[model samples]
Target: MPEPVVVDAMGGDHGPAETVGGAVLARREHGVPVVLVGRAGEIRAELARHGAVDEIDVVHAEEAVPMGERGTGGAASGASSLRVGCELLRQGAGSALVSAGSTGAVVSCAIRGVGRAPAVLRPALAIALPAVTGGATVLIDAGATSDPTPEMVAQFALLGASYARLVLGAADPSVGLLSIGAEPGKGNRLTRRVAELLPLLPLRFHGNVEGHDVLAGAVDVIVTDGFTGNVVLKNVEGAVRAVLTLVARSGTAAPEALREVARRYGPETHGGAVLLGLSGTVVVAHGSSRAATVARACAVAHDLAGGGVAARLRDHLTAEPVN
Candidate 1:
């Protein structure tokens, strides 16, 4: 069994209810311990509601950091639930940390509190997105850096490749540079440069792949700048939602069957994303996550923790450099 995962119970939009409920569900179903970090009273109350008050543990933090709250310089004060959650990972008291806080704040506090793995300059977020192949593909820098350099994209490819190998268990995870077209020279200078550089990496680089390639399962890993990656992710999510809606109204199936169809398109279907390139496990859940989604995030965190993802990533990175 892995160590407990620290949940930032106050970070998401729904606060203690959904966050704490998720923790309870994770502990009950997955048997992973959860340290709920937030206002102690509210967390305790939520836990009691789930009849898990005695089963789980609560760590008290004086304040709750809301979504959109800036890190270090905003109206919010210093020392947040995210900070405490990261500290749990740093101290080895927790195997990983899950939060739905501001992405920027989580990234900032994670870098400052947990620190980066050796040779990892910036931490990247890697997500497993549903594809047309009936499986998921890894898209890195989903929302981490806004303007990542080609070298950074290369680094993302490396990390993403490792994730596909270890987490997804791919033999030779084919890496793709997310571009406008499949041609080597297509896309912006950064994409072309990254496409040119990725093959020299230790992992198997599949050359340039386009957006449709993301779902086509043409490649296992897709690497791009956070700005472009975020945009593509949002658009894909919207498209999935629309498809699910149509499926529900299609009259070809019962509501329960339609729900299964919707489940296939759910954003939470892949759980939370791991913040790669960091020294420890850090999972970030969607802000609107329900209990099951949060529980799934916890299970993913447990997988990374038990697998030693961060250490393997560090070793992989130290062995290579941007070409």
Candidate 2:
């Protein structure tokens, strides 16, 4: 049997409850192995609530990291469940780690515990969004590093391309630098420099793609700094929700059609973003995730770890010589 996926059971808004419930769902419905790390008593109580006591393993953790912790404070201090879960992953106690904790804390702890892959200046978060062109688009730096240098952004492009091919199965994926305009040298200084460097790398560079190009499938992989990428992600979610509401209110789309569209874009559909460029797999779900989202995250992490995403990315980066 494969090693279990480690979950920070007390890291999210409704953890121990939601996380533990999700673990039960993953085990019962998905047949995936999971180990929950947090306050053992609380986890048992929640599991008992679902009549699932002792069905999953619970690793004890004394403290919990606050959801409001964005900075380096208190995060690095002690044996928090987030850190313990990362340590479990680093020590090979689990195949992957899933957390809906603070994105910054998760990234920082994973980098410190699981470490970065070879030649990775900084780790990035990548997610595939359903596109208008039938397939999906891989968006990198979804919220991992907000102020990476130009060189780091270029590396994010490579990571995104690899993720497209490996996880999303986009054969020979083409990458685009997300920019203000769809022309060369058309973005801020960071994007301009990154645009210059991308073509020099060992991937198919698609020049610059404007905002609309993201969902148009103009390129398989879209790369940008975390700040902009995060904004784009939230904006896309809000825009989709608003558009669906308008369509339903106007009776322009059939009820089933609108339901299918909403299901495709739901957070439960994708589970979460994979923290790319790490030495191991870590899926960071939305902090406000529910049990369904948590279960999906565990399944996603198990599949990614089984596919050796982190090792494959490490080997790819090493062979490509990103310098």
User: Which one wins on lDDT?
Assistant: 2
What's the TM for model 1? 0.78
C-alpha positional error of residue 72 in candidate 1 after TM-score superposition, expressed in Å: 8.7
Q: In TM-score terms, which candidate is top? A: 1
The sequence of per-residue lDDT tens digits that candidate 2 reaches over residues 1-323 is 98999988997888777888888898888889999998999999999999888688889999999998873866656888888888887677888889888777887778677766556778788988888988889989888889999878988887788778876778899998999998896999999999888888778998899899878877899999999998998888788889999989997779999888887776424445788766567988888888888888888888877876545544444433232
| TM, every model | 0.78, 0.76
Model 1 global lDDT (CA atoms, 0 to 1):
0.77
In model 2, what lDDT does residue 194 have? 92
Instruction: Give candidate 2's TM-score.
Output: 0.76
* Candidate 1 local Cα displacement, residue 299, angstroms: 1.6
**Clashing residue pairs found in predicted model 1:** none
RMSD, model 1, all Cα superposed? 4.5
Residue 97's lDDT within candidate 1 is 88
Residue ranges of candidate 1 with Cα displaced over 4 Å = 1-3, 49-55, 67-76, 90-92, 101-105, 108-113, 165-169, 185-187, 237-270, 319-323
